[model samples]
Target chain A: MLARTSLRELRHRPLRTALALTGVAVATAMLVDMLMLGGGIQRSFEELLRSRGYELRLSPRGTLPFDTEATISGYAELRDALASVPEVAGVAPVLAYSISVETTDSPDEPQTSLRALALGIDPREQGLLRLLEGELPGSGEVLLDRRTIEETPLSVGDTVDLRVAGGLDVAARSGRARVSGIAEFVFSAREDRPIALPLEDLQSFSEMGDVVSFAMVRLTDGSEPDRVRADITARIDRVEVTTLTGIVTEANERLSYFRQLALILGSVSLVVTALLVGTIMAVSISERLGTIAALRAIGIPRMRILRALTAESLALCALAGLAGLGLGVVVAGVLEDILSDFPGLPQAVDFFVMRPSTLLLAYLLLLLVGAGAGLVPAWRATGLEVASLLHAEEP
Target chain B: MSPAGPARDTRGVIVVATDVTRDYRMSGSIVRALRGVSLSIPEGDFLAITGPSGSGKSTLLHLLGGVDVPTAGNVRFLDRDLGSMSVEARASLRLREVGLVFQRFHLLPMLTALENVELPLAAVGLGPGERRARAEERLVRVDLGDRLDHRPGELSGGQRQRVAIARALANDPAIVLADEPTGELDRSTSRSVLDLFRRLNDDGTTIVVATHDLELAEGARRRLEVVDGRVEA
Candidate 1:
C-alpha cells in the first residue's frame, strides 16, 4: 500500500514525472554507450586478430606487421626455416605495393588508369585474403576486393596493365595481369581498392628481389602460441615475432583515446543522472513534507515513510536505465557505422562492441546512483519536527 | 498550587503531566510556551484545554499526546515516560493508543476520504479488507460515508474535517487528542463536531480538545483555561 501511495504521488503530477524520466533516460543512454565504448575497440580488435587462426606474425624488426613500408628480404628462405620449427603449421609471407593499372577503353575514349594497392602473397597459404566471389588468383591473375569492384570499373575478368607506383619505380617495372577473382582484403579500409597476386610475380615485376612486407604464422591445432612464438623468434633472425595478444595490447594502447573518452563521458553522464534523480526526489519530497509529518504524527513509522521515498527514486532510475539501454544499443549501431568508415582501419574490427559486463556495470551504477540520490531527501523528510508541523494545523 | 500534579488514583488516570514546561528557541532567543504547567487526563474523560492564540494550549496538547517532550518536568502516557521512549516505540504507542485530529484537516490531498481515514489503520498493520471496512465505518460515524471516495481537495470544509476526525478514530485509540477540531468549521458544523465529541465521550472514549472556541470548550465535561502558559482551571 505504501508503494502504491508512492507511485500515485509520482503520477499525481504527470508532467514533472515525464520530464524527470526524459532527463534521466537521456543520461542513462549516454552512460550505456560510453560503457560499450570503454573497451569495445580492444575487444573487437582481439576478435579480428584471432578470426583467421593465425597465432603469430613476423613483422620487420621494431614494427607491427605491415604497419610500415619496411620489407623483409629472402622471404622464401625465411618461410622454409620457420616451417621447420616444431608446432609450426605453415608460414605465408605478404608484401604491399601500389601500382597504376590502366584498362583498355573503347577506341573513341582514352585509356583509364587508376592507382591501386596490391598485395603479393602465395595463393595457397596466406591468411589475409578470403575468397568471396571467385577462385583464388594464379600467377598471371590478380584478385580485387569487393570495394574495388564496386568503386572502380574493374571486375573479375578484366585484363589490366600494371606498373610499380608510389615509390622509386613510378613506371619503371611494368607488367600485365588478368583480374581472376574478387576477394575480401581484411586489412583494407572501406575506400581502399586492393589487389592480391602471386608473390614471385610481384617480386620480379616490382624488382624487389625476394622481399616481402611481413609473414603470418598459423600454428597447428592445439599448439600454444607462446611456445611457437619463442621457436619462430629463435629460428628467424631480423624478424620480430608478435603474438596476437601482443598486437592487440599495442593497438589498445594506441587507441587509449577511446577508453579515456568513454571514462570521462561516462562519469559526466553518471553525475548528470545523479543530479537529475536527486533534484526530482528532493522536490517531490519537499512538496509532501506536510503530509509526511502528518503521517508521522498518525503513527506511521519513519522507516516506512523513508522506504516509500526510496522506492520512488529506485524505480525512476531503474526504469530510465532500462529504457536507456534499449536506446543505447541503437545509438551504438549508428556510431559504430560512422566509426568503421574511418580510413585505414581493419575491415573486421567493430568500433563499439557490446558485452554483458558493460550492460551489467551500467545498470548497477544507476541503482547505486538512485539510492544515493534518494537518501538525502528521505532523511530530510523524516527529520522534520512532527509536533510543530502537525500542530501548525491547530489554529 | 500543590505542584500542579494529577490525582494519585493511577487506575483512573491515563495521562499525567507533572509541572511540564515547554520552551522554544526562536531566532536565538528562548521563548517559554508552557511554564511548569501540569495537568491530568482520566480514563473516559472529555477534557478541553482552552486558550487564545499563543497561550500554549496546542503545546500542552502536543506534550499530552506524546508528540513532544517537555523542556523541564515530564509527561507520562499510562505511567510510561514519554521522554524516555524511543522514537519508534513512541510512534507505536501513538498507533495503538492515541488518536490526534487537527483543525486544518490535514488530509493528504492525493488520497480519497476513505484512504485518509485508513492511514492510521494501515499504520497499525491492519490488512487491506479490514482497514477499508473499518475506515468506511469510521467515516459513516462522522456522517461522511457518502464522501468516502472524494479527495480532500474535492470536499467541502465540513466534509474534510469529518474525514480527519474519522481518520483520528480509525485505530480505535484509548484517547482522542483533537487540536482545535472545530476551530476551522462554521457555526453549524462546529456544533455538529462538538456534538460528535460529546457522543464519543458518552461512548466511553477519553477525549482531549485544545481550542479557543468557548462553545466547544464548554461542551466538554471538564475545562482547563490557560493564560501565559499557566492553567487557570
Candidate 2:
C-alpha cells in the first residue's frame, strides 16, 4: 500500500518529479564519465604496445622508450648477437630522427617546409606499419604517415626533399626519395608527423651507420619475456631491456593522477546528487505535512510512513539511473572524439571507454545516494506532532 | 511495563481522563490548551463536547483518542495508563481500539475514496482482499458507495467528510472521536453527517463528538461545555 501511494503521489506531481529526476540523471552521467576516463587511455596504450607482436624493447640505459637523440652505438654487433639467441624469433632495429621536408612543387617557399619524424626500418620486416594505400617503401622510396600526407598535399609517386636535423654528435644530412605509400604507425605520438624509409638508405644519408635508437624484439612462441629480458641484460651492457608488460605497468603508474582526478570529480557529483534529491524531498514533505499529521493521528506507524517516502525516492532514482547510462555513453563518445585530436595524445588512445561492471556499480551507488537523501525528510515527517497539527489552522 | 494488548476488557469504561492539563510552549509563553479537565466515556455511549474557539474541546477529544498525552495528569484507555505508554504503543492501541475524524476531511488528495478509507486497514497489516472488502463496507455505511472511485478533489465537502469517517471506521475500533466533522459543510450536509453518526451510535459503536454547533450538541445523549480549557456543568 505504501508503495502504491508513493507512486500515485509522484505521478500527480509530474513537474517536480521531472526536475528531481533530471538532477539525479545528470549526476549519474558525470559519475559514469569519470569511471570511463579512469582507465580508457591506459588500456588503449597497452593495446598499441602489443599490436606489433614485439615482446621486448631495447633502448639506451636510463632513458624512456622513444626519447629523442638517445641512440645505441654498435647496434650491428648487438643485432647479430640477439639474433643468435635461441629464444629470439626476429630483431628489428629502428632509427628515430626529426627532419624538415619541403614540397617539390614549392621548393623555396617557407610554408612548404614541414617538420616530421623520420623512422628508419628494414623493408623486409613484416608486421610493422599498416599500409592504407600504395606499397611499403623499397630501397629508394619513403612511406609517409597519413597525417603528414594530409598536411602537405603529398601523395604516392611524389618526390620530396628531406633535411635531417642535427643531433648530439651527428651531422646533418639531406636526400630526396619517391613517396611509395601512406600508412599509420601505432606508436606515433599525436603531434608526430612520421615518414618511413629503408634502414640502410637512411643510415647512409644521415652518416649514422651502425647506430639505431631502439630495437623491437619478437620472441619465439612460448618464450617468457621476463626470462628473455633477464638473459639479454646479462649478455649486454650499456642498454636497458624491458618487456612490453613492464612498459605498460610503468605507464599505468604514471597515469595515477588521472584516476585521482576522476575520484575527486566523482565525489563531487555524488554530493550534488544527494543535495539535489534531499532538497526536493524536504520541500515535498513540508508541503504534505498536514496529510502526514492526519495519517499519524489515524494510527499509522512512523516507520511505515518512512518506508513509503523512501520507496518514492528509489523509484525516481531507478529511472534516472537508466536515463543517465544512455546520456553518459553519448557524453563519453563526444569527449573521446574531442580529446582524440588533442595535440600530443596518441591517435590510438581513446580518452573515454565504457566497462559494463563499472557502470553497474555507478548505478547502484546512485540508488544508495537516493535512499540516503530521503532520510532527512522521512525523519521530519515522523517527528510531526499529530494532535497539535490536526487542530491547528492550515498554513 | 505490562503488555497492554489493545485493552479488550475496560470494565465498562472505554476512556477515562483525570485532571488532564496540556501546555504548549509557543515562542516564549506557556499557553495551556487544557487545564484540570476530567471526563469519562463509557462503552456504547454517545457524548458531545461543545465549546467556543480556543476552548480546548479538540484537545480533550485528542486525549480521549490516545493521540496525545496529558502534560499534568493521566488518560486511561481501556484501563491502561496512556501517559506511561510509548508513542508506538499508543499508536498500536489506537489502531486496534480508537478512530479519529478531523474537521478538514484529511483524505489523501491523490487517492480514491476507497483507497483513502483503506489506509488504516493497511496500517493494521490487513490482507489486500480483506482491506478492500472492509473499506468498501465502511464506505457503503457512510453512504459513499456510489463515489468509491472519486478523488477528494472531485468530491463535495460532505462526501469528503464521509470518506474520512469511513476511513476512521476501517479497523472496527471501539470508539470514534470526531472534531468538528461538519465545520466545513453547509447546514443540510452537516445534519446528514450527524444523522450518519447517530446511526453508527445506534449500531453500538461509541461516538464522541466535539463541536461548537448547538444542534449537534443537542442530538447527543450526554453534553458538556468547555470554557478557558475547563469543563463546566
Candidate 3:
C-alpha cells in the first residue's frame, strides 16, 4: 500500500528524489565509517593479544611491549617461578635488542653490514611470529625477517655474523649464525628490520646474562585470567603482569583521539542526513500542498497521510542506506590502508573494523533520521485549511 | 444508461447549521466570511447557495460539509453535533457521508481518473479489487467509463469535473457539497457537469452546489442566496 501511494509520490519528482538519495547515501556512508573506526583499533588490538592463546603478558614495570629498553634482570628464576604457578600452562621469555651483522657464508656478494632489531625467544614456547619458509632458529641458526633478507643478499641456508649492538666492546658479545628460515613477525612495523634467534644465543650475544625484556604466559583453558594474574603479581617482583583486557583498555585510552574524531564526524553525518532529508521533504510537501489538502478534503486521515510521507522518506533512506553500507566498506578499506601507515603500528592491526553491531547501528540511525525528517512537514501539510485551499484562496 | 438513485434511507434532516459565523484574521483585522447564517439541508434535497466571489457562499458550504468549523454557532449532522467531534471523526464523517467538490475539480493530477475515484474508496478500507470495481462503476455512471486510464492532465475540464463528481459519489454519500461544480468549465461543459448533477438529484441523491453563476443556481430545486455573509431576502 505504501509502495503505491508513498513511493509514487517520490517517483513523481525524479530529480529531487535522486538528489535526496545521493545526499543521504554520502552522509550514511560517512556515519558507517565512523562507527567502524570508533572500535576497530581497540578490537584489533584485543584480537592480536589473544591471537596466540596467551592471555597474559609480563612486561617490565610501567612499560608496554617494545615501549622502553628496560629489561627484567635475573629473568631465569622469575620464568621458572612463573612456570610453577598452578594455572600456568607454559611461559616464553623474550628479549629485544639491536644487532649488527654481515653475511659470513655468502661469498658471491660483498659483505654489507646492517643493524636490525633482534628478538631472542625460547623457540619451542614462543607465540610471536610464524615461519614462512624454513624452520625456527635452533642452536646455531637464525630466522631473518623478510625486510632483513631484502636488504642483505642472504637467504635461508646462508650464514651471517651477529654482534650485540650499542656496547663499548663489540667483539665480546658476538657470534655467527646460519640462516634457518624467513619469518612473519607479528608486530613488525614498516620501518622495522628484525631477526630472531634462540634466547641463549641472544643472551650470549648481548652479554646480558639471564635477562629478557618480557614473557608471554599462556593460561590453562577455563582458568580465570585475573586469578592467575593476581597470583603472579603477588609471587613475582620487578615485573608487571598484564591481562589481555588490561592491554586493550590501555590501548583504548591511547586511541582516545581517534575515538573523539569518530564521534564528532559521526554526529555531523547524522545531522547532514537529517537536514538533507528534512529540507527535501519539506520542499516536496510544500509543492504538493494542494494535492495533500484535497486528499484531506476527500477524507484521508491525517495519520495515514503522515504515514505515507514518512514511508516515502524511509524508502529513500533504506535504498540509499544500503548503498551507503557497501560504499562505507570500500571507504573504510581505503581509510584503513592510509591510516595503517602511521608509525609504530603493527602491520597485522586494522584501524577500521566492521562488525554486525556497527552495521545495525548505522541502519537504525538512518531510520530515525527518516522518521524525524518527514514528521514536521507532514504535520503541516495535513494541518492545512481544506476549504480555503480548495477555493484557491490563501489561508 | 441509468444512474443509481439516492440511498433509500428514510431520515428527514441530513445537516443543520445554526447562526454560523466564520471569520478570518487578515493583516491584524477580522474579516467575517460568514455572519450569523443559519440553514438546514434535508435528505435528497437539491440545494444551491449562490453568491459572488468572497460573498461567503463557499464558507457556508464548507461549514455544512464539516470541513470547516463555525466561529460562533453549532453544526449538526444526522442529529450529532459536528463541532464536538474529534478531528479524525469529522474527517471520517466527511469521508463516509459528505462528498466535497471544488471549483477547480481538484482531481489529483498525478492519478489516473480511476485512481482518483478510488481514493475515497481506499480510505473506506475497500480492497484493491473492491476499490477498483466501485471506482469503475462510479466513473461509468458519470459517462467517463472510457476515460478511466486517462490522467486529469489528459482530460478536458468537463471530464475532470466529471471524475471529481464520480469521486464524490464513490462511497454513495448521503449528500455531496460542491463548492463550484462547473466554475472552470465552458458554458457547454458546465451544462454537461450540471446535467450530471441534475440526473443524480433526479434519482434522489442530495446535493448542494455553491456557485456565482445564476443559471447554474437556477437548476437547483431549492436556492438560498447569500450576500455579504447573510441570507438574501
Candidate 4:
C-alpha cells in the first residue's frame, strides 16, 4: 500500500517529482564520488608504501628537510655495519630524486616531473626485480620506472638524455645506456610519471659517487620490529634509522588531508540533499492536504500516515541514490585523465567499489535524511481536523 | 467474522455522546464548532443528522466516529467512555469497531473498487484472499460486484459512494458514521446509495448519516437537526 501510494503521488505531479529527484541525485552523486575518491587514494598510497619491503622508515636525527635528498652514503658505512645486528636480515640502499620525462620532441609539450627512486643494490640478494622484459641492470645499465616505461619515449637500448642535479653541484649529460628492463614498485607514491636508473649511473650524473639515498631494512623476525627499531636507534648516531612502519604512518597522515577535504565536501552535499528532500516533502504534503484529510476521515490511523509518507520519501531517496551512484561512476571515469596529473591522488576512483563499512554508513545517513524529511508532514497530516476539512468548501 | 460472533457485548446502547463540544482555534481565535451537543443512539438503529453548512452536523459525525476528540465532553461506546481512552486506544476502537464514510466518497484514488473496500480490513490484519472475498461480497451487496476492478476515477460519483459504503462495512463495524454520503450525487444516484444504506441497516449495522437533505433525514429511524451548534426539535 505504501509503495502504491508513493507511485500514485509521484505520478500525479511528474514534473515536480522529476525535479526533486534530480536534485537528490546530483547531491548524492557528488557525495559518493568524494567518498570513493578518498577511499581509493588512501588505498593506492598504502599499496605504494607497502611495496618498498620495509616495516618502518628511519629518518636522520630530526626531520629531513623538504625536497632535500636523504642520502644513505652519509651513513653507508653504518648501514653495512647493521649486518651484525641479529634482528636485521637484509638491507637495500635506495636513492630518491625528481627528474623530467620528455614525452614529445616539441619542447613546447608539457614536461612531466617524474619521481625516480634509484636503488643501489646487488640484485642477487632478495631480488627486487620482477622484470617485465630484459634482465636487471649489471653495472652501467639503467631500468625505466614502471609508470613512464612506455610513455617516456625510451625503448630498450635507447640512448637516454639525462640532467641530474642536487642543490649546488649538478651536471647535464646524455649517455647511451641500455634500458635493462621495466619494473613496478608496489606503491606508485609518485604521480603517473616515474623513472628508475642504476644507482651508480645516477651517482655519476649527479657528481656524487658511492652515496646511496636510504636503506630499506627487512627484518628476519617480523614479531620483533619494535624491539629491532629501538636497538637500531640505540646503536646508530648522526643518521636517523627508521623502520618501514614509521613511513607508512607518515604517509597515512599525508593522505588524510586530501581525503578529509573530499569528506567535507561530501558532507556539505549531503546537507544540501537533506534540504532538497525536506522541501520536496513539505511541498508535497501541503499540496496533498485534501487527500491526507480524506484518509484520516476514513479511519486511517496517524501511524499509517507517518509510515506512508516516510515510505514515499525513502523510496524517492533510494532511487536518487541509485541514479547518483551511476553518475558518480561516470564522473570518476571522466575525471581519471585530468586527475592523473595530481601527484598524491590516485588517477581514478574505484567506481562501484564501496567498502561494506562505508556503504553501511551512507545507508544510515540516507535513511535518517528520508525519515526527517517525512516527519513534519506526517505530523501535520495526523494533527489535521477531519471535520473542518470535509465540511469546508473545496478550493 | 460475523457481527453475531461471540466477541461483541450487545446488551447496551451502542453510542452515547454526553455534552460533546468540539472547539477550534481559527487565526488565534477560539471558535466552538459543537457546543454541548449530547445524544444517545441505540443498537441496530439508523440515525440521520441534518443541519445547515455551519451548524456542526459534520462535527457531530466526526465525534461519533471517534475521528476527533471533543473539547470538553465525552462520548461513550457500549458503556466505555471514549474520552478516557488514549489516542492509540481510540484508533484501535475505530479500526476494530467504528467505520467512517466521507462526502466526496473519500475513496483512495490509487485503489480499485475492491481494493478500496478491502482497505479497512487491512487494519484487522485480514489476509489478501479473505479481504478480497469479503470485499467482493460487500460490493455485490452494494450492486457494484461487476465494477470491482474500476478505480474511483472510472466510476461515477454514485458508484464511488457505493464502493465507499462497501469499504465502511468491510470490518463489520458495529457503527458506520457517514458525513454527507449523498451530497455529491444526483437525485436518482442519491436514492440508490440511500437504499443501499437502508438495506445495510436492515441487515443490523447501526448507521449514522450526516446530511442536509430532508429526504435522507426522513428515511432514518431517528433524526436530529442542529442550528448554531444546538440540537433543534
Model number with the top DockQ: 2
- DockQ for every model, please: 0.59, 0.61, 0.59, 0.52
Docking class for model 4 is: medium
TM-score of the second chain in candidate 1: 0.93
Greater-DockQ candidate between 1 and 4: 1
lDDT of 4 at A141: 69
Per-residue lDDT tens digits of candidate 3, residues B1-233?
11232243356889989999999887899999999988988998999898777899888888898888898999988777888988788888888888888777777777899999998888778889988999999999999999999989999999999999999999888899997777788899888887898999998799999987677889899999899999994
Error of 3 at B39 (Å): 1.1
Residue runs of model 3 more than 4 Å from their true location after superposition: A1-3, A101-114, A146-154, A163-174, A388-395, B1-9
- Which stretch of 10 consecutive residues in model 4 chain A shows the poorest summed lDDT? A344-353
Model 1 agreement with the true structure over A160-190: per-residue lDDT tens digits = 8887644564446678889899898877777
Task: Looking at model 1, give its docking quality level.
Answer: medium
Name the weakest run of 10 consecutive residues (lDDT summed) in model 1 chain A. Answer: A164-173
What proportion of the true contacts does each candidate reproduce? 0.73, 0.68, 0.64, 0.38
**Candidate closer to the true structure by lDDT (higher is better), 1 or 4:** 1
Better of 2 and 3 by TM-score: 3
Model 2, span B1-233: residue lDDT tens: 11213437647889899999999888999999999998888999999999888889998898888899999999988888999999988888887788888888888887899999888888877778988999999999999999999999999999999999999888888899999988888999999988999999999899999998788888898999999899996
| Per-candidate clash tally | 0, 0, 0, 14
lDDT, model 4, position A298? 60
TM-score between candidate 4 and the true structure: 0.88
Worst 10 residues of 3 chain A by lDDT: A164-173
DockQ of predicted candidate 4:
0.52
Off by over 4 Å in 1: A106-112, A166-171, A391-395, B1-10
